[model samples]
Target: MKSRLNVVFTCFLLLPSMVFAEAQSRPRAVDDFFANREILATVYFTVGSAQLNRAGEQVLDKLVPEIEQLDPDVHLVRIEGVHPRKDHDRMTELAMLRAKTILEYLHHRLTVPVDLTLTGSSPSPEVRRAGRSQHRADIVVYDNLFDPHTADTNEALSR
Candidate 1:
């Protein structure tokens, strides 16, 4: 009788976790998060500047609306900066700064909080050429429409 009672008590305690695990394993929300990945905005900068130009500002302005619509808790944002220069280090630094500038502007303009990350890359040619593509940052937003029925059980279980 005592053993049976203990088993019953254990099951009662484990029920919630078991249910949570099942929900997390369903993967519909995860699928949507992955499926909705694309670059939403691309902001360009001038040579030797980490600041936003008029065109960059205009582009970011349009991006604000898209950012506002995302669920803060469910989405992921990545700003990838690409700057090309003769000096690799200089280009990488500029790229990273440009990305940060974009991130700050978006955060300032929107109430939606996001999981944002910054990445920088530099493609430098030994001799300078007309490569305007070097000074640009791509802002990617993942439209993670979460499944309300399923919680983030994987994280809970790991904890």
Candidate 2:
């Protein structure tokens, strides 16, 4: 009886920690959770400038409605800015600036927070040879339409 009581007490003591560990291990953001299901859109930019030209604006105009229809709830929009330049630091800065510009344009339409990623130029020789295509920003819209049901099923399966 004493041994059984000790075992029960030990389990009680560890229960909270186990729960916490599980929670910590779980995907924290909506983006991370629904990363697999996403819509990608690209906005091209001029070299060495973060300004959104006519083409970029046109891309965003079409992209905004698609994103709105995907999920009404708060979703994650990942904006990755890519530069053609070889300078990592400068490219990163330019990429970030471009991402921010895109984010600002989408902010009014999107209720959810936007995550930015400054991905420098492609290291691939083929892409490097491809020219101006690398000077673009890729927007990944992560939708969460079926997240609740999926989460419930996942939780049930985990247990």
Candidate 3:
């Protein structure tokens, strides 16, 4: 009886995780967030400048509707800025500043609380680039569109 009870309890504990995993793996509500229903896009900038040019600004403008539709409880927006192969520290700072600028634009212009994060590469050119792809940024955005809760949980467990 004791062994049987343990097995039943274990199954019960695992069931919710399995169900939630399945639900998270499926595509989510994006149409409510964007006019075109695409929840994500990347904006590129010149190698040394964090400034958004006319085209970058246009893309950001296009995302206003999606930012407005984000569900605070269910979704999170992460912004990352990258620098090409160069001074990592300076580039990281610039990227973070750029991310903040974008967040402010989203908040004031689009009425969305855009969460921003900055990342920098600490690796050598060999590790960082695929030379064929001319595009490179020292910073980038890490998206957490699905399973953020589980990710947080896993992070905690690792610690």
Best by lDDT: 1
Give Cα-based local distance difference scores for all models.
Answer: 0.69, 0.62, 0.50
lDDT of 2 by residue, 1-159 (tens): 978954654454344335445764654453345445464788888888999998888888888766665543445456767666544656756766787798888876565544433233332456677654777888875544344554567753543
Q: Kindly indicate the candidate among 2 and 3 with the higher lDDT.
A: 2
Clashing pairs in 2: none
Cα distance off (Å), candidate 1, residue 93:
0.7
Candidate 3 lDDT, tens digit per residue, 1-159? 978954654454344335445664633333222222222656666666666677767778887787667664455565544444434456545555565566655567666455543333322355465552212222222234344463466553543
lDDT of 1: 0.69
**Candidate 3: where are CA atoms >4 Å away?**
1-39, 112-128, 131-159
lDDT of 3: 0.50
Scored against the true structure, residue 55 in model 3 reaches a CA lDDT of 73
Q: Where does candidate 2 stray beyond 4 Å?
A: 1-39, 72-75, 85-87, 109-132, 143-149, 152-159
Per-residue error for 144 in candidate 2, Å, reads 5.4
List runs of model 1 lying over 4 Å from the truth.
Answer: 1-36, 85-87, 123-132, 143-159
Winner by lDDT between candidate 2 and candidate 1: 1
Clashes of each: 0, 0, 10
RMSD to the hidden true structure, all candidates = 16.0, 14.7, 15.1
